[model samples]
Target: MKKYKLILFSTLSLLITPVYANDNAEQLFNERCAACHSINDNSHITLRERLQEKAPTLYYAGNKFNRAWLQTWLAAPSKIRPGGYSFFNNVNVTDEGDVIDESKITTHIAVNSTLAALLTDYLMAQTPKSDLIALEKVTLGKINRSLGSKDFNKFKGCGSCHQDEEGYGGVSGPQLYESIQRLQPEFIASYTRNPEAWDPKTLMPNRHLNDNSIKKLLNYLNVISQ
Candidate 1:
């Protein structure tokens, strides 16, 4: 009778303990996705790095992707690329554009549906620690695309490696058409300031701009986001 009671208690502990102590979802995320996605800061490598392809960072996954959509995406990985998620601009890690290999991504372990649901629930709960401050109230008007092009090419030297319509840059960086929606300013600013903060293997060079240029570029990015 004591052995039967011990067995029952052990079974109950196995069932109930996981609910309290399990963090497998995060472990799974770190193991599978951390190679490509960043959560906190800029990477040490250039944006052209293979590990730095065009996938949106998980740092803002809580903000950008809706819960239901993320879950469905996990269950059945589909082609979300129109042209490609990551494109080469000019710093030149590869030819054309770099593509993030998301073809064999696993949203959940091959466990039962119940465990899959639990993983999804945990993943959706991860929100960025920083608040995203929208610049809509500050800009008050649209940024001129022509001026933006000029600034990107001539003033900031952004076009030296990144591609823009001005026909003056390299194809080493990712295209920046709708990047404002994809990247968080916090990560962008930090990377702009220091690429080593994120990944140690980045190839992008650090800029020597003063504070004013940084502010201008940041504001430019904010303006384009609109």
Candidate 2:
């Protein structure tokens, strides 16, 4: 009888531990992250609110980021966008051109390894736009580096905002060289197709790229990321 009671207790503990951990993670996120990063669905966000947002919305983080990359990034956060999340707040008009005021750019809050893992696990479950991600069909194909570079820099003009290489291109947007590692492939394709659908007030313009163009861009991104 005692042995059976012990076995039941062990089984009950195993079932309850996951729920407890998940609850703890949720509480931690609410305390440590809710002030800056929003975990709620922000589809109805106004332009004024978006302009005032301190960080990117994480409601679709599961669909947007690679799990490994998100986990690693949380442990030791680095500057992805050189001009910060709201670029207008950090730009300084200079004689040469509009330069990013590095002083205004603040570092992301880093978490310890244990907390990072817990937060990442919780954040990675917030996939509200799984349907949107599903609609994107990403296929890796070869693209000529010279032609791709020409299209990205001159014709498409992505270089005006994003960097394809370190210390090169514009600084207003996140660096694209590491995007393949940082973002999910489906997210990359979907965002490229329609940035406004994902981020209502994003500075990225709607290029209305066709399927072939988007695929070519994805190929280019993969190449550069490698």
The alpha-carbon lDDT assigned to residue 162 of candidate 1 equals: 58
Provide backbone clash counts, one per model.
19, 0
- lDDT tens per residue, model 1, 1-226: 9999999999977754454226577765555456666555443446456454646556545544545655655665543322233433312344754433344332332344455465567755665433432311222234567776677778778766555532335544544444454454554555566654443555567776665566566666666656
Question: Which of the numbered candidates is closest to the native, going by highest TM-score?
Answer: 2
What number of backbone clashes does candidate 1 have, counting pairs of residues 3 or more apart or in separate chains? 19
**lDDT, candidate 2, 149-208, per-residue tens:** 888999999999998988788887899989989999999999989998788878899999
Query: Candidate 2: which stretches are off by over 4 Å?
Result: 1-22
Clashing pairs in 2: none
| TM-score (C-alpha) between model 2 and the true structure | 0.87
- What candidate 1 gets wrong by more than 4 Å, as runs, is 1-23, 27-143, 164-169
